[model samples]
Target: MKMAARTKARHESLGLSLEDVVQMYRVMLQTRMIGERMMQLNRMGKAMFVGVADGHEAAEVGSAWCIRKGVDWCVPYYRDVGVALVLGQTAKDQFLGVFAKATDPNSGGRQIVNQFSDVKAKMLSGSVHIATQFPHAVGLALAAKIRKQDHIVVTYGGEGATSPGDFHEAMNFAAVHELPVVFVIENNQYAISTPVKLQMAVANVADRAAAYGMPGVIADGTDVLDVYEKTKQACDRARGGDGPTLVEVKCYRYRPHSSDDDDSRYRSKDELQAWLQKDPIDKAAAYLLQQAVAASRLEDMRQEIAADIEAAITAAENDPDPDPATLTRYVYGEDAE
Candidate 1:
């Protein structure tokens, strides 16, 4: 089926094929589905914890889709399931991580489910301390520059992390050295239980980019295409040796901080329902259907993805836990030769 005139024009302007856009929507859908299923598993006591990725799929998927996977580096935070998936991580990999199975590629079940790293994908694992990834990302970018490589690093964190000291240091270092890195602040309007209004004095997180002498851009995280366009521009600038760009994507969080927190204490049901009306998955599905993509075709895609998720869950469940004997292997360094 042919794309709608408007859709085709937009993709053409961005130099993206219709198939590429469809793939973006597909990844977003899969990410959302994986989060939902993970939550169900948490409720069923299959997993220890879960973080919801419902509202941030567009921001995560759109930004990651712009990168060259293994060619570029990604330092994603705890809620970046969509980013990990786009960076060559399979649903089985995610499930294994969540299940804390010995087969978990990131940490062999030692770290949290979201702390993902793939050496082959050039994606770094995140830490519990917020904003720590910024410094690591800056280091990666600095190394690439020293080696005269064309690689760029894409790092993600919440607006709340911007308050930390490391955030400033990383930004300053990147700007001073003209490091090729893109900092994405996924401002989901809440830092766990604290609302954005309570977290900082500034309105937009991107506003702080001025202090570090870098360009700042704001985009609607709910609009996948808009995000893709903005991120692509930032990455291109970095590749051209123009230094880092701070992108603040305004979005909403549909779930609580984690499987443990109660969101109703700080947020009203009405507010969440309002954001649900603008859900990225729903928006993309509607747009595709309008472009002559049949509803049956979309449903088939959903079914296929659901089956893939289930298969991952089954494989992870069958996998064993990390052996106790190997518990301290990675925790501490061994004696040097």
Candidate 2:
């Protein structure tokens, strides 16, 4: 479906130039393409398991765009491929990780697929355990505060993570300490097979933010501009020493929880179809067209990104696997070399 008519005034009000909007759309498109390719690889049995950020591009890209890469820190969850891409992780880098190649930058084939990390980008490696990154983010923020640094930390997780004790502990500590951090909950309406209704009694995940003494803001995750604007405000507040803010982006994931999941067992096909109608990439493209970006230009952008992803996959497939002798290298101090 087409998004509301895009106006120059709207993006301008958000301090975004037309070119900036175009670039944002490009990132969203690139994110979707990469996820799709990963799923294909998983289906071909080239990758053991995969998680696609099929419907989370806008939320991930928009919020990530607000951070100063290499200065501010990002502690993202597993489904934040768009965040990693925005923070300077290349498509080849991601492909290498998924292919479990020796040169994989995140962990040299040690970590699971999609557990993204880039040292130069200041993005921490994600843990397999849910809500663990919340405390990690708060710790990073605490360090920044002690150092009198201007940078802030941003952490992301699904709504299911909010139900964990670590999430609550991190939020309370960050709030009490007035730490510079932003807690981003990408509420995709489901936690594996469990829907949000079963996860919490609250109407929204942001609603719980007030209990921790921070402002809670909700944004349309399908709208890149809205996500960018709200996340930017929260980031600015944290950078200005106003402490943490909980920003909840309402989104829907088109794919199953993982390659191993069978979504049909929990959600109905009609429901999936309904969410597909509001695909974030389509919404972004519609806005671009309304901004007078030629349709051909959008198609060409897709083609370019598709070719790039194909090249990345091919290169990653050809890359060598980790040697058996190095299995205990990073796991042991003396064997690291």
Query: Using Cα atoms with residue i matched to residue i, what is each candidate's TM-score against the true structure?
Result: 0.95, 0.96
lDDT of 1 by residue, 45-76 (tens): 99999897889999999889889967999999
Cα lDDT tens digits for candidate 2, 1-337? 9898865567899998989989888888898899888998899988999998989999999999999988999999999999999999889999999999999999999999988877898999878999999999999999999999988999999999999999999999999999999999999999999999999999999999899999999989988999999999999999899999999999999999999999999999999889889888899888889878899999999899999999999999999999989898766556323
User: lDDT (CA) for every model shown?
Assistant: 0.91, 0.93
Q: What lDDT is obtained when candidate 1 is compared to the true structure?
A: 0.91
- State residue 61's C-alpha deviation in candidate 1, in Å: 0.5
Error of 1 at 327 (Å): 0.7
Clashes of each: 0, 0
> Local error of candidate 1 at 264, Å?
0.5
